[model samples]
Target: MIATPQSCQELLAHMVGFDTVVAYHSGVAEAERKLSDYLAGLATAWGFTVRELPIEGACGNLLIEHCIDPTLPWLMFDSHMDTVGVEGMTIDPFGGEIRDGRLYGRGACDTKGTGAAMLWALREYAAGSQKPRNIAVLFSVGEEHVQTGARAFVEQHLALLDWTPAGVVAGEPTQMQVLGATGGFVRWKMTTLGQACHSSKPDRGHNAIYDMARLVTALEDDYIGKIRATHPLVGNASAAITVINGGKQVNVVPAEATITFDRRLVPGEDGQRELNAVQALAAQVAASRPGMQVTHHQFESAPPMGTVDGGQFANQAVTALEGVGISSEVAGEPFTTNGNHFAAAGIPTIVVGPGDIAQAHTPDEWVSLEELDRGIAGYAAIMKS
Candidate 1:
């Protein structure tokens, strides 16, 4: 289990072979559970203590530890096990093909590469000359969707340890940069209700689509421009209409129309307050019309990764990357990560990992083998810190 470049690639290939997409219908996805089993088996064989946490509404998590001394604090690393769906991929999504010095697969770049690198790094650290700190690796699930895995871990499983971790590095596609901040998000759906009738007698029916059009226009014209509150690291908040559905048949006027939007939250802003503002705007739109009826359903509100109590650790992480010949600085990401959960729990959390974020969830996702090797070295150096 020495984490060489070749070994990391081989491990990533095995990881990519499992289709661990979050199954919303069945709660924790079966493939994700299987993948966790596989990693737990490997950790057990390598002399690490493994604990399985079967989450209720998400794919479960694995907490694998190597305790050199029980009295010492721990350094934990987290990387999710689930990936987004692979519907429009151009290449074999699970093939793990190698070409032009890159490894191509669904989760190769987004996160599986980081998990593999971390495992290999831990392998080396356990056998290294200086084992100053106990190490823990959290392979969390449901990161691509609701982030329930990380949330559950912070809320429930963190007490399993004798003391809180000294620092936590949540693995993500950061191009080897240390991330200090990341945006959070809130998603909601709105449905407009109206009377339905045959298209031949359209005058007798009230058009829900027409009402929905007005609401969408109001969101674009009035609401989108107002959420301009900015943070120095993560930048401005954004609102986008991502999904719309209406009409049951061509011959009938639609009775209901639904639209979903995502609102990105910056560091200082509050998710609940912003969601309330959107609801207020939609209520205004409905009030202006004679018979418009609208309903709002808030899906989820997740907080952003703001400055942690242990902010000084970012400097140590940067220095660690520098030691491995990878020039890195403290930066921010527009997208969110599992680090948000740790940061909310008052742990010194930073996001860093192997690949580029641009390749994540793309049709032809990939990770450069050379960068992955460097990632292994960088993680090893961080462990030493």
Candidate 2:
């Protein structure tokens, strides 16, 4: 079930071989389990207490604990094990080919590659005699879909892992930069109902689609102002109606219409506030037409958090980066992550990892070999303090 560091890399290649792209409604299985087993075995080899967090029957988070003197607080570095869907790629999607100083495949950048880096770091620290503090490494799942994996892990095991020493580095694509701020994520669906009628009786039926289009136009303009009023980081809180499908084949006067929203609220803005504003907009549109009803529902949500420029926990890692050749600066982003959940739960969390976000989820997604080395060294330095 376990292997040497040299073999660990090969094991990781096998882990990535399974297409573990988590769909919120779907789940992770073989690949994620192998990943958990690999970490669990390594943790056991290194004298750690291992706990498995499962997602829809699969190992979600493998909490590996290495304790020495509990006198000092512990350090935790967390990364997800799931990858986004493989949409486009030129080579073998699961090949794990390491050519030209880069690893090419689906999970290479978005996650599994980072998982390999963390495993390599664990091997490095486990072999060293630095007498590192109680280091807890968490490899979480479902980060590509919902925050379910980490959210569940925190709810079930945060009390055990919650130690107050350094900080929690949420390993993600940062191109080796430490992230300070993260965007909020939310999704809503709006529907309009109308009385069904024959195609020839169109005049008699209040077409739901025509009514929904009116609401969509209103949503894209005036209602978004509520979000724009409190924009930060990259830009204003953004919203787009990504999906709209109604009715059967076009012969009849369709009785129903619906639109799905993709909204990105910036950090510092309460997630509930955006929901309320969108609801208000729906109410306003519904009031205009009493016969055709309008309703909205929230499908997904993640809170936003600002960056910490100079906190003891935040600065420790920043300070460590400077020890190497890397200079540090705080950054705020318009993307959401489990960091939102960690920060919401009162843990100081920041984003850090190798590779570029631009390459994430793309076909043939890859990370430079140099970034992997950098990520390993940088992660090792963070726990060194």
Candidate 3:
């Protein structure tokens, strides 16, 4: 049913060949479809069931079930099937080239590597080396998009399974560090409305840009401090005015100004509380600047997750990692990832995988040949134990 370590290494190269980038849309998300095809093939070849989750009128998540034995519980090896942009990749993002022992490609380190390792580990379990503890290998989609993949899997597919497994090891690039936390992201757009007037006269009309500018400055000087002053593992929260635009004509004061806000919060900071914080800050700014009405609204919200300790999943993960010759210590990440979705569902989740997160989605993005092997062996130890 399965092969040796070399067989697994070869499979990692194959997965890297498919450009499972974050850019996908419409019915079967081009990238997801490609991944689905590859995964379906693996399912058939490896004797696993292939199930597709129809997200937003399309196949959003791909679940490959490896039921080595029905009597044992499960061990979920989760990896995302989506990547970021491939704007200026020197090597073809989908080349899957293994040069000098390193794989040069887009999603190589970000996740494809983890997926491959998980696959190989499952195969090893199926290989009957020692009748590996019940386990299931999952290749989730849309992890780079909106975390819809993990969310769907946790809600829809978990019930479909006969055994929910001992725990889930979400493979995201931990560089081998056990990740137990993820900072929250709250994105919003603020618009300022004012009466249009001739710029030269300055008396007959209002300047929306000026109003927005005041809000931005106040937010930077005041509100930014209120929210950004602290965090436990991820450091202090942050907010930045990334975009702003308000101009109708050279001589006219624009009647509307818009600004985009990027806010990151530490765990325990409620999403709504963050929104309220913005609203409260805007009210203060408006009070100081007459005719400056700032409206705060949320466009995106990723609830944060805290470091999980004292849980069965955490203990088992620690033991599994230790059994593999690598001990794991619980840690947190400053950025947001799909782990948040499952964490929000009260699932004890950790984001760990190969490759340095620093190289993720970068131009010359690449993963070390050594790390790939460690990831495979480490994951195998987890599933087998």
Which candidate's lDDT is highest?
1
lDDT of each: 0.88, 0.73, 0.75
Clashes of 3: 2
Angstrom error of the Cα, residue 153, model 1: value is 0.9
Worst 10-residue lDDT window for candidate 2 reads: 225-234
Candidate 3 displacement at residue 153 in angstroms: 2.8
lDDT of candidate 1 over 1-385, digit per residue (tens): 5322348789898889888876763344455887788898888888999988777745578988999899888999999988888888999989989899999999999889999999989999998988889999999988887787889988987776566888899999898999989999988899999999999998899999999999999999999976678888788889899999999999999999999989999898888888888899999999999789999885886799987764588888999899879999988877889998899898889999999999999999999999889888998999987
Which is better, 1 or 3, measured by lDDT? 1
Instruction: List the candidate 3 regions with Cα displacement exceeding 4 Å.
Output: 1-6, 24-30, 68-71, 129-132, 159-165, 228-231, 308-312
lDDT tens digits, residue span 1-385, model 2: 4654564356456666766767543443544666567667766876778887565665668877677777867777788877766655787878888788777888788877666777677667777888558777788877876676778766766655445525577888787777777788788788898877888878877789988988888887777544553444446677888999898867788888988988887766776777787888788888887676887765788877665444456667778877776667666678877777777676778878877889888876888878877888878777775
Kindly list the per-residue Cα lDDT of model 3 for residues 91-185, writing each as its tens digit. 78887777887887887888888888777767767776676566666777777756767877777877876666456788877777777777888
